[model samples]
Target: MSVDNISRADELVPSRYAVPVGDIEVLVISDGVLPITASTLATTTPPAELAGWLDDQFLPRDVVDWPLNVVVVRTEGRTILVDAGLGVEFPDFPRAGQTVARLEAAGIDPGAVTDVVLTHLHMDHIGGLLTEGLKARLRPDLQVHVASREAEFWEKPDFSHTVMPQPIPDVLRRTATQFLNDYRGQMRTFEAECEVAPGVLVSRTGGHTPGHSIVRLESCGERLTFAGDAVFAPGFDNPQWQNGFEHDPEEAARVRVNLLREVAATGEALVATHLPFPSVCHVATAGDVFRCVPAVWDY
Candidate 1:
């Protein structure tokens, strides 16, 4: 079971990576990559500063390949999935929406998933809950947990925004409505924070979205945090930088800083959805700044 053949630099690396947390076993699966221009991150930062930072990190200044790492936790006889990736396909993001394929690659049967915990209702996070034709895709019996506010926000017709074009939001709302209606009995919502499974808790970390949250897993004294787009890697190290895609840049920045500090202090392993593939890492303080130290892959 050695993963010695897998390399991060490979264009098509293995879709699943194993993470050990005491007695619990966690699987990090790749949904796919989303290509975004580096300039779009921290839009307010000066171009010179941003370029210098990217240079220091040895990252391409023009564009970055943002990977989608969806976590699967198996504990207490339960199979729980965190954040469904983009459904079947996304025309705007050609490389995205490979969650289903990746899950199968990891030998996980979709029917075995007892719960789907959505970190937020963003298109990328919730899109995988339905088929391209806008039909529920997960097992009808599995419970789907989402933030109460997030579900409400998408149901309204006037939840307009400048982040995405008019058509995008419209489609999102439509699909959201369909999902809610199709799985009325299985859909559930929570407020603030609550334990969704035996050792999994969802805590609201609003800023990215009204009801956005990060999932916390604890078992046998080991802990892991599934940070759903709370922040990106390098830009987020400087908490002051604001992402252009954030619904509330100021609040998002505040939450990101707090989360980094908390993880650093508690020694919690973090899995950021938008970081590079196999996004499991630990946060640490480097002088006055925060840095991401990637976790070594375990077979």
Candidate 2:
């Protein structure tokens, strides 16, 4: 199939994946649709060839689920939402809009939000920031933090021309501009690892985005990391396998290799943006190999 055909196919299916993490209960809220197509999933492989490969691997018949898993973290005194799922409006997409609703379902109020730390400014990650009128959708007064490096990358003069899908850059530009204006002084950015809270820290993990970040939660000797799009699916047995959508596949592969090693060595439970619903998994290493063993949380 052609790339255009694959893009069309991806618009159909979407899945929501999440898991509860530590005292800071985290959920992977879904927004938008996820469709698996030859180009989006395995662009390098010929459409027919990739179809055969996926079939052999026992993946969905011809498509893999392309759901967006937005991470929401709930903490005491304040509710922290990692990435906002899509709002009710967008040109061509369906949203769960459950970020706040689900939070309410969990007994969380939108006004209770104290901080909203973004992993990056991608549409799926930041779209939940507002309603059509620019009103704060989730938590109006929430402090929205984005990585400085990422903010600077797309803001560059040549970034628009560099992006593969032009809409990706355009969306970021619109969202950031609006966020900067609406949130104003509430917007804060960091360059490297900084403790966002007593037990939560944000670490820079670029490659997927120029300034993509992952959140770390350390409490009562239990440490958990919310890896946003860094390790998509553990999709491949090789921990180093790179996804097709990565901004810099080589750099992304390297980051995953290192992360897998570190997570395994420390035996930390991680919540990934895309891993399968309730995406909490622990890393176990055997010699040079690392595996993601999904863990069942008591909560």
Candidate 3:
């Protein structure tokens, strides 16, 4: 390639997708990929069964790269950011934590983000806010919207049921603590459900964490659900398969099943945290299981 072409390729591919939910503008920004043990994704499934599923999907059997996705919702006069991606603080995850850069490339100003809706206090969800780079650019009046139970859970998070790596639990605890300490003054706790903006609703699901939540946008006649961690890539195919990241795997699975059914019934689009990049898709019931029909790119 010529030097000019190379130099001009800074962000030719913005790695972001925009979908309009009626009048509400939704942008799904990719935060790159987070690598995790493949086994962890199917903690409740048998080893052979998990391997078969992975092979069917043409995915790696050991380490799998999860597509980390975040969202920006513009409704009325307010700009809301969904869950923050993995930040740049941990040298361990170099490929992840590209949320801040991608946001800037998409022409979104952090200062204009009036509120941040956190699904839970998991490090991957809240680490971006603790980053020195993004934190410095955000406005002082930014309101961090989280479920009241979520904030309380992080105070004494119970990871007994999860199957994450040893070092991960400690790191998660530390990151969550730091995030709360830094943003406590801006916290806006909500109960079961609250409308953050016009037609944008966040409700506690309480499966992945005690206060894990999901954001739903309903405007005019269109609808979309940003299902934080309540839904994952494998969730559509095996809604009963519990994930290791879930604080309560059984309840998490139940929540996943119910959410999938609801989305399928309503025929609204679904975006998830660990689904494929720009994970905008419609759900369809496949007998007992469900399917994610990827939405056409809206250019």
On TM-score, the candidate that comes out on top is 3
Give the distance in Å from residue 12's predicted Cα in candidate 3 to where it truly belongs. Answer: 5.1
| Segments in model 1 whose C-alpha atoms lie over 4 Å from true places | 1-12, 132-137, 157-178
Model 1 lDDT, full chain set: 0.77
Residue pairs whose backbone atoms clash in candidate 2: 17-277, 18-278, 34-66
Which is superior by TM-score, 1 or 2? Answer: 1
- Candidate order by lDDT, decreasing, is 3, 1, 2
- In terms of lDDT, the best-performing candidate is 3
lDDT tens digits, residues 1-299, model 1? Answer: 11122223334667778887877789988888877778767688999999998898788999877788888988888889998887664667767777766675677877789888888776678767664432344466798888888777666744422254346666767777766786668877888887877878899888877888999989889999999989688644687787766777788888898999999999989998888878888888987679888888766
Residue 241 local lDDT, model 1:
85
The CA lDDT of each predicted structure is: 0.77, 0.64, 0.88
lDDT of 3 at 129: 88
lDDT of 3 by residue, 1-299 (tens): 11111121266655788899999999999887878999998987999999999999999999999888999999889999998888778778877777777777777878889999999999889988876756778989999999999999999989899999879999999999999899999999988998899899999999999999999999999999999999888888898888888999889989999999999999999999999988889999999999989988766
Task: Rank the models by TM-score, top first.
Answer: 3, 1, 2
Q: What tens-digit string does per-residue lDDT give for candidate 2 at 130-237?
A: 645334444556687778887776565234212234465567577766655666577788988767677878899987877889898877677888888788754335
